[model samples]
Target: MKLGVVGLGSMGYGIAASLLRAGHEVCGADVNCEAVERLRTEGAMSEEIVTAAPDLHALVIVVLNSAQTESVLFSENGLAPKLTPGAVVICCVTVPPDFARAMAARCGAFGVHFLDAPISGGSVKAAQGKLSIMASGTAQAFEAARPMLDATAETVFKLGDSAGTGSAMKAVNQMLAGTHIAAMAEAITFGMTQGISPDTFLQVIPDCAGTSWMLENRAPHVVAGDYTPHSAVDIWPKDLGIVLDAARASKFSAPLTATALQQFIAASGMGLGREDDAAVTKVYARNAGLTLPGEE
Candidate 1:
């Protein structure tokens, strides 16, 4: 299959690599020329995404937010219009449910199929082609997208036969994921104040009842004091903000989510926006006058 992938960041690049390994002809685009070039060396198509759009059987959008997703599909010279009738747009970006529904309607007008398919399992799983996709769309959309889906996902949950359901599920996921990461940072730093080293906290927690996937996954970064971003601190603000907005719309109280958002905001304010999200511990450390591993 011929596919186009927009936004070749960590997860996007991994998805593109997986598609290439699956023997698909992949054309990748990114504002980062190096990412595009990097994927090209690994056998992705070198053609410009715009020039290749007309022939693409599917397009996977892994951009950061809904705005970029909209621009990719609906902006002037957007790829949606350029795609042949019956092509599928697999949107992996997390977005509002209403916005997903709206984009589906707009794409339908152009005779394109839109799948609200937000993904999880992070960059590692994406590169391994083991991602979990929470997807919803018309049956026809699923059929049109199956090839790329098979190439990219290990588990594909069919949520509903419409666009909004998938985004709704993604919102739920981000809410817990953001909250857990913040909670993990808080607990690890709080332990530090009691003279429990980050390394000791990591060693003991994963076996405990209180441990979570986020805690196990991110705590190693804190222990090693490595802030290099596999996922950045700034992402939580936008993602958790999305969760809070959706919560507010439903009259849901998300105090934990709100508190987590503030911690990420403070981390961003401390010039750690581009650092690994585990660096949220720094916010707590600063408030308590404690130093993290590398800083010490």
Candidate 2:
């Protein structure tokens, strides 16, 4: 398959690499010249995606938000108009359901099939070609995107045959994901206040019923004092914001999601936005006047 991947960030770069490994002809584009160059060295090409747009069977868009996704597909120099009919667009960003529907409608007008596909499983799984994709779209869209999906995902849940269903599922996942991370941060720091070191918490908690997947995954980052981002602190504000937006539209109250959003917001406001989301523990640490592993 001939594919184009826009946004060579952590997740995007991994998806492109996986596609290349699967013996596809892959082209990558990113605002980050260094990331683009790195992909080029790995047998991915960067020769003007627009020129190859018509020939591409799939374009996997892994940009950050709905706005960037829209700009990449429909704005000046966007590729939607250039792509040949029957081409599939695999949109892997976290976005609202309504936004996904709008993109699907727009792509339909151009004779392109849009997959409302949002991915999970973090950078490690992304690099391993083991990510989970929550996807919904027309049967034609599924048929068009199957090769790329096979290359990039270990688990592809066919949630529905429509645009918004996939995004709605992703929003539900993000609500749980974000809340779990925040809860892990809270618990780890509360342990510190009780004279339990992080190492002790890690060593013992995984054996306990209180342990969660997020705790197991993120607690090690705290133990090592590494704030390097697998998922950055800034992402929650966007994802949880999407959840809250949808909640408001449905007239549903979500106090827990709202609370989790505030903790992430506080983490970002404390200049940790670009750091790993595990830094949400820093908010708890600051409040209790205790230090994490690497701090003085």
Candidate 3:
């Protein structure tokens, strides 16, 4: 398959690598020249996406949000018009369902297939070609994207035969994931106030009924004092904001989601937006005047 990945961030780079390993002809593009060069060294094509657009069988978008995704596909010099008529645009960004539907419609007008395919399982899983994709699209779009999907995803949930369902499902996922990470931060820091060290909390939580995938995955970062972002703090404010917006549109009550969004916003306000999301623990730490593991 001839594929192009438009964002070379952690998750995007991983997806590009997985496609290359699957023996696809993969070209990568990013605003970060270094990320493009890094993937080039790993057997991705060095050609810019514009140059490669005509021959691309599928273009996978792993950009940050709806706006970037829109710009990538439909901006003045967007790739959608440059693509071959039958080429598939596989959108892996978390976005509002309406945005996904609109993008799908626009792509259809260009005779391009649009797959509203939002992904999960993070960078490690993406690099291993083990990502879980929540995908919704026409059968033709799915067929057009199958080779790329086979290379990049371990599980593809065919959510519906339209564009919005996949993004809607991704919203549900982000609501829970962001909330869980916040809950994990709160619990770990709350334990610190009780003299239960972060280390001790990590040691016991996974074996307890209250533990979650977020706790097991993120608590270790807090314990090690490593804020290096596999997923950054800034992601939550946007993703959870999408969740809350969708919830409000449906008149849904989401008190916990609202609370979690505020904590992440506070974490961002404290200049922790670029840090590992586990660093939300720092917000609690500051509120309680408790020093975390690596703080002086």
Candidate 4:
């Protein structure tokens, strides 16, 4: 398949690499010139994405939010208008259900297939071509996107036969994921106040009932003091904001999600926005006057 990938950030770059590995003709673009150059070295098409857009059979958008996704598809120099009819767009941004539906509808007008496909499992899984994709769209959209999905996803859950359903499912996953990361920070730091080391917390927690996927995945980052961003601290605010907005529209009270969102906001405020999200533990560490791993 001839594919175009926009964004080329951690997740986007990995998805593009996976497509390249699957022997697809891939053209990649990003604001980061280095990322685009790196993909070019990995055999991605050297032509500009705009130049490649019309000939693309599929375009995988892995941008940060709905705004960027909209700009890529509908704004000036948007690629949607340039795509051939029956081309598929697999949108992997974490966005609201309504936005997904709207993008799908607009793509329908252009005879393009839009897949409301939000992904999970972070950078490592993305690099490994093992991410979980929560996806929904028309049957034709699914058919159009299946090859790209197979190249990039280890698990693809077909949530429903419509655009909104996949985003709704992703929202639910984000709510829980955000809360668990925050809870892990709280518990690990509380243990430190009682003289439990971050290393000890990691050793014991994974075998305990309190262990969660987020806890297991992120706690090790804190233990090693490596704040290298597999997933950055700032992502929670946008993702959780989507969850809370949806919850609000449904008149749902999500006290836990609200609280977790605040902690991530505080982490960002503390100049850890670009750090790994496990650094949320820094908030608790500061409050208790405890030094964490990698702290002086």
Candidate 5:
């Protein structure tokens, strides 16, 4: 299949690389020219994407949010006008269900299949093709995107054959994912006040049920004191913001998710927004006057 992947941020870059490695004819675009050039060096041809857009079997959009996704698919230089009839559009942005439904309907009018496919397992898993994909769409969408899914995911849960369910499930996952990350930050720093070092906590916590998928994955970055972002601190504010927005739309009271959003907000206020999401712990660390690993 000829594949065009848009957005080469941490997650999107990994997805595009995984597709290339899977032997697809892939073209990549990113606002970061360096990322696009890197993909060019990896055997994806820039000339091919534009000239071949009409024959492209699938277009995988792994952008940060819905706006970017829409821009790539339907904006001025949008690929929707160029994509072949019956081609599939795979969306990997974290977005509201209504937005997902709207995108699906718009694509349907173009004789294109749209998949509401938001991803999980972060960048590491994305690079390794071990990420989990929560996906939903028409039967045609899934069929068209199957090869890409098989190449890029360890597990693909078909949540429903409609636009909204995948985004809904992604919202549920983000609610838990954001909450777990915040809880991990809190517990690790609280342990520090009691004399348990971040290193020691990393050594002990994974074996306990108090641990979570996020803790097991992100805690090591805290212990290593490497805040170089695999997932940036600012992503949570957007993702949890999506969760809270959807919650508001549904009149749902999500107290835990709300609290987690505040902690991430505090982390951003501390100027850690550009750092790794694990740096949320630093908010707690600073509040208690505690030193973390690699601190002065």
Candidate 6:
């Protein structure tokens, strides 16, 4: 298969490398010239993505949000017009289901298969090609995307026979994920107020019922005082915004998710927007006037 991956951030870069290793001819592009050159050295084709359109069997868009995803496919230099009729587009952004449905319809006009495929398991898993993919699309879209999915995913969940469902499920997952991160911050900080160290919280929490993938993955960054952004505080605002918007449309009450969204917002407002999301703990620490470890 010939594949083109746009947006070579941590996740996109890994997905492109995985495709390249799976014997697919991969063309990778990004605004980051350094990343493109690096991947080029790793056997990725150096052509600008637009130039590789007609040759690509699958075009994976792992950008940040719905607008960027739409821009990549429909912008002035967009690939849709240049794509071969049966080519598939696997959209892996966190977006609303209605947006996914709309994109699918538009892609249908050009005979391009659009799969609403949002991914999980973060950058490390992405590098190992073991991410979990929540995917939904028309049968033709699935058939066209299967090879690429097989190359990148450890678990490819077929959510439905249309594009929106995958986005719907992704919204659900983000609600829980965003909430978990905020909850972890709250719990860890609360433990500190009672004289428990972040290290102690981490050691005991994983075996408790409160443990979650997000907590185990993120809490260590707090304990080590490594605020480097594997996933930034800004990401949750976008992801959880998608969740709340979806919930609003469906009249679903997501009070817990709503509260969690506020903490990330506060963290970003405090100029911590680009920090690792575990930095949400700062919101809790500031409130209680408790200094977290590694902080002055």
What are the Cα lDDT values of the candidates? Answer: 0.93, 0.95, 0.94, 0.95, 0.90, 0.92
lDDT of 2: 0.95
Q: What TM-score fits each model?
A: 0.99, 0.99, 0.99, 0.99, 0.97, 0.98
Per-residue lDDT, model 3, residue 71, is 96
Over the stretch 71-99, how does candidate 4's per-residue lDDT look in tens digits?
A: 99999999999999999999999999999
Query: Least accurate stretch of 10 residues (summed lDDT) in model 4?
Result: 287-296
265: Cα error in model 4, Å:
0.5
Residue 5 of model 4 has an lDDT of 95
Clashes of 2: 0
How much does each candidate deviate from the true structure in C-alpha RMSD?
0.7, 0.7, 0.7, 0.6, 1.2, 0.9
RMSD of 5: 1.2
Which residue ranges in model 2 land beyond 4 Å of their true spot? none
> Mind giving the per-residue lDDT tens digits that candidate 6 earns over 1-296?
78999889989999999998899999987889999999999998868788889999999998888899889999998898899999999999889999999999998899899999999988888998999999999889999998889989999999999989999999889888899999999999999989899999999999999899989999999899899988999999999998898788889999999999999999999999999999999999999998887896
Report lDDT (Cα) of residue 243, candidate 5.
93
Model 2 — TM-score against the truth? 0.99
- What digit string (tens of lDDT, one per residue) describes model 2 on residues 138-219? 9999999999899989999999999999999999999999999999999999999899999999999999999888999999
lDDT agreement of model 3 with the native: 0.94
Q: Once superposed on the true structure, which residue ranges of model 6 sit more than 4 Å away at CA?
A: none
The number of residue pairs in model 3 that clash at the backbone is 0
